[model samples]
Target: MAKDILHMTYENSLTFAQDLDRDDPLRHFRNKFHIPQLNDKDVIYFTGNSLGLQPKNTRVYIEEELEGWATLGVDGHFHSQKRPWFYYHKFSKEALAKIVGAKPSEVVSMNNLTVNLHLMMVSFYRPTSSRFKIMIEAGAFPSDQYAVESQIKFHGYNYEDALIEISPREGEYHLRTEDILSKIEENKDSLALVLFGGVQYYTGQLFDIGSITAAGHWAGAIVGFDLAHAAGNVPLNLHNDQVDFAAWCSYKYLNSGPGGVSGIFVHEKHGDAELPRFAGWWGHNESERFKMKKGFIPMSGADGWQLSNVNILSSAAHLAALEIYDEAGMEALRQKSIRLTGFMEYLLNGFNLGDDVLKIITPTDPAARGCQLSLLVSKNGKAIFEHLTRSGVVADWREPDVIRVAPVPLYNTFEDVYNFCEILKKVIF
Candidate 1:
């Protein structure tokens, strides 16, 4: 499948980029999104890692829910024919299950990512005096770090003692799989949970979730992931990997609007486990939910983790974006993502920007990354980023130095990548 990319020669020319686009089966998918404009022209958007562009169908989907609410009033909970608000959360189940490689019953579109992460920790992060420590990558997204630390403190352990952060060796930008496994083994006796981001946001490294899960399980720890930068950006097999739990926000690669609904996956083996969880009426058995009874009988599978009913307006936007994923499919999107990102890498390397000027910090291996490439600028990084912005290239700049760019597969094109590189080269050189 990758033979073409492995052997193909790349040219730094508009015609070559156009030729790649002309042959791309997923090229038309870009039309489904509304590209942002800059100075009367469409901007070259490469910040899907920060926030995904608005899908063209988002308004249509949101309006449907508005119309239902306008006409059906309170009865919309049950009588709205198309998608009753009462069962709104279920609408995203099948599509999300396929995206995350979980059974329909094992996945749920629910609260925001951090909320779901806290909820999952409530159930899985049980700590004892002997096995009370949590292990995480050193630089996980801030929200995950905050959530994990708070969970530790809430469990009556000082985070300084209970949180074990695995750092890359000196002079490294990404963690080696062996180093991660070794850390897990070294802390096996004290590790209570092993949590990591599906992709390291700063470095854009796609962790080996399957291998990490195996190692964590071997260490007698529950394994979970925060898939914020990963969910729709890369193909995932959470269930087959035996991941205990995972959560992801929809605003990034999922292409839902900002603060869109988040999804959670719980391995089916935990579907019926008598675990402790913060329960609400929505998570109770559906038939008995409105009975207003004293006892809380949780529903089966991931649905039991729900704390409240789905947010319909935001979820509608999610459905619209997910419709695209359902159509484009992860496997096809990933194939294009590899070639598109590889093409960008090829173009950047052609610039001969020495490490003293610009260096790509992301892993060079295609399998070790998604579409995002983190460029570490040696000097004047912010000025270069601002220059690209002025030139109508939308990219992300992390604090201090790194510039992150992601050419999303569902909407970005080879031409977009080529054009951005051309703009970037002009600014840097």
Candidate 2:
């Protein structure tokens, strides 16, 4: 039997929002973004896990750069907009460092996701004859898998010999941290590196990076994270965690446009470490980069990782997004996220859609995940997904089973959650 129908009134929503907004330190942040529209109405968008809505300031930022390019030409590299292209990446470093909790010297914005992954692999994936295995979560993003497999082959090792995957236990939706640590211990002698997403893309499970790094170190292996789904959505103290290195794309939670420049974090400890890496002219010492020297003398810090002159348009989008993050602050954003996502969970459970019909696979513990909830629609995941799309609920569907909904706190509100729940109830009924 269905429970009582939950009638939502505008006043109830207003009251609930009033209380939440009263305590919401980041409530004012809603005005900072550009919400999308469908049929002249703003659809309830809950898919920041896939692509974040644009920031309203994005166009202004891009136009400034475009105007500078038109007015100053090559001179724009040194003197054009208030933010010079020559040092444009610098403006975002302080803000990016704060988001991932790293020193300014440790973070730099550069190429796209796959490209950055390949670059980091060049530096970190040193597989020896004896210790030649790399460990990653079983269901890693396909692009990451391709990059890792190609790297293994490039190093003259068979894929089977070079990769070790930690999978969920039978019948379990999530992996236990203990199990991951156990796997590290068992393969200690053979593993060269432990690399996995800071947050699993499909499951939204935030891996325990600190503990994972500790275990990998105990096993005499280097540890790193691909934080595409984790960065900006959760608090990641990469510096304090002391991980070897990490990378993340800015398009998702960071709210940069599609295919925006990505970021990399190289712990300050490795600032001067002589690691074999694929270098480019851009990585050369700044004062001498234009001198056309015979040999590569890398810049002193993470900036040394750059493989090319910065893409100003992409970097401009990131700069625009970063300004919002700096103003709102990650802690303040995360506070609203907890309540927004919690409210989503509350509404989802209240649907009383039988467990056999649909189930949330993301971990229930707040500490173990970010803003996303991956719902496994057991009956007709694709059809339900189509219904959602047609109904103007912009959620995304993963193959075979999941529909990911992320109520990003930067712009989402209690009303969005309530409206989404109402739509979901109608879809199920």
Cα lDDT tens digits for candidate 2, 1-429: 011112222233546755766776777788888778889888888888888889999999999999999999999999984988888778899999999989999999999888888888888888889998999999899878999999899999999978999899999888999999999999999999899999999999999999999999999998989999999999999999999899999999999999989999999998778988889988888899888979999988798888899999989989999999898888777766777777778778777878799889999877788999999999878988899888778998898888999999998888787877777878878
**Model 1 pairs whose backbones collide:** none
Model 2 score (lDDT): 0.87
> Lowest summed-lDDT stretch of 10 residues in model 1?
1-10
Give me the candidate number with maximum TM-score. 1
Per-residue lDDT value at 101 in model 1: 91
Q: What is the lDDT of residue 320 in candidate 2?
A: 94
lDDT of each: 0.92, 0.87
Q: What ranges in model 1 sit over 4 Å off?
A: none
TM for candidate 1 is 0.99
Per-residue lDDT tens digits of candidate 1, residues 1-429?
A: 477754467888999999999999998888999999988999999999989999999999999889999998999999988889999988899899988899999999998989999999999999999999999999889988999989998989998999999888999899999999999999999999999999999999999999999999999999999999999988899999999999999999998988888999999999989999999889999998888999889999999999898799999999999999999999899888998899999999998969889899999988899999999998889999999999998999999899999999888888999999988888887
